[model samples]
Each structure stands twice: as C-alpha cells, then as structure tokens.
Target: METWGFEASNVAVAQVRIEQQLVEAATRAGLTNLRVTTDSEVETIGPTQWLGAEVQANLLWTPTFAFLDALAAWPEGFRVTGFQYEMQPLTPLQQEAGMTAPTGSVRIGVAFPVILPPTAAAPAAAGAGS
Candidate 1:
C-alpha cells in the first residue's frame, strides 16, 4: 500500500495520468493480479478549491525490490505515506498449484490535487440595448 500527491491541469486529466502511471509502474515491477481503483474529493480554502483523489491498488506476489522499483518510477509531486503487507501459508489448492512462498495482498492509496478555474457568470452581450 502507498500514498501519492499529484498536480495536474485538472481532475480528469490527473486521474488519467495517475492511472496510467500506476499501471505502467506495476507492470515494470512485475506485480501480478494487479487491480486499481480511485476515489475523488474536493477541499476549499477561502476562494480556492482543490481537487483530491485516492487510488487504491491491490496486488498479489509483490516483492520488496519490486515495490521499491515502482516507488522510484513516480515523478516529483508524488510520495508514499505508508504500506501494509501480510504473509500467510499457502492453502492446499495453492500448494497443488506449485506455489511455494507465502501469498498476500497489497493496497496502495494515492492522493492527487488540482486547482480548478474560478466559476463566474457570463457578461451580457454588447449592443443589446443599442
């Protein structure tokens, strides 16, 4: 599990880029059974509003070095808040399937921030009263 901070032109653009980066990084890291999902949020301060999002990815058979490699691939404005890992003995089915090592899942939480343009009403057309 990991957390990230990002800045983009807009929320939609940010979501697309984040998803792309995550999938690419995961592929490079050799993470199997990768699954990704995202949740969005908004925060306002004074006249400013910020778009926020969280990406959660689940994976199987992720190694330490692989995780590090994926972490390194992220560009600036991104960071890892924390991670969680658990290992358990393989079940009979898994054993028969030739699985040797412990199996577990990973959940990655990534957050993004984007500044939206200020909303305003349109001005009246000229010559309307002329």
Candidate 2:
C-alpha cells in the first residue's frame, strides 16, 4: 500500500465537509478568525457501543462580541451541541487501531457511519439488521 498526503477516512471526510459548511456559514455571517475541526472515535467514549458513531468538533476561537451575539441570535440549524471545548486528542490505542485491520485486535469502535434521512438510511439499515 501507499501513504500519500493524508488519505482521509470516511469520518475524516465527513468532518472536513462539516467544518467547511460551518466555516462558510460563519464567514457569510461575518464571523472572523474562527477555526473548526472534527474527529470521531467510539472506543474511548466508554461503554463501547458497536453501532454508535460519535463526532467531536473542536471550535478554537474566541469570537468577537458581535459575532457571539449574532451566533446566539442567528437561526437555521447551527447544531453546535455545545460551546465549551472537550479534550479528545486521539489516544495511543485509537491511533494503533486506526492503523491496523480489526480481525485479531481489540480496540472497539464503529466500523461505518450511520447518516440520517429515512430514504437514505432505509436500505442500509435494513441490510444491516439482516
């Protein structure tokens, strides 16, 4: 195999897309100097859910007063969950698990993402249940 300039995983791609969306929205809304990033891992979430997918977005910026006020009052699904930051910088186990095949190892995490919309999820959910 080959390791080029970072071949992003499914979750990574999703995170990047989400980041872009947020950034674009913020930019359009006239927010400045904000940075958003996301990453996912289930094993470290505790209680180990095989079918669970968790995404963590780190918003690293102290917004201006106007930006904050605008963000608070703005509508149209900001969906930030929370404003406070969480410290989830990739554990060693997670790094190891990501690098290896999951046949004989044990670092529990979600293998695939489960996205929304009844139409889109129907087929995949049905197949998965079977």
Count of backbone collisions in candidate 1 = 1
TM-score of 1: 0.58
Q: Candidate 2 residues 38-118, lDDT tens each?
A: 444211112211123222222323332333444445332222333343344556797777843221211111122223223
How far does residue 30 in candidate 2 sit from its true spot (Å)?
1.1
Compute the lDDT for candidate 2: 0.35
Candidate 2 residue runs with Cα over 4 Å from true position:
1-9, 42-78, 84-130
- What residue runs in model 1 are displaced by over 4 Å at the alpha carbon? 1-7, 42-64, 96-98, 112-130
Model 1 Cα lDDT, one tens digit per residue, 1-130? 1122454555556567667776777767776676655444344434433333333334354554575566566553444444666667789999999988776667655444344433210111122334
Clash pairs, model 1 backbone: 1-107
Best candidate (score: TM-score): 1
State the displacement of the C-alpha of residue 15, model 2, in Å, after optimal TM-score superposition.
Answer: 1.0
Q: What is the lDDT of residue 50 in candidate 2?
A: 15
Whole-model lDDT values for every prediction:
0.52, 0.35
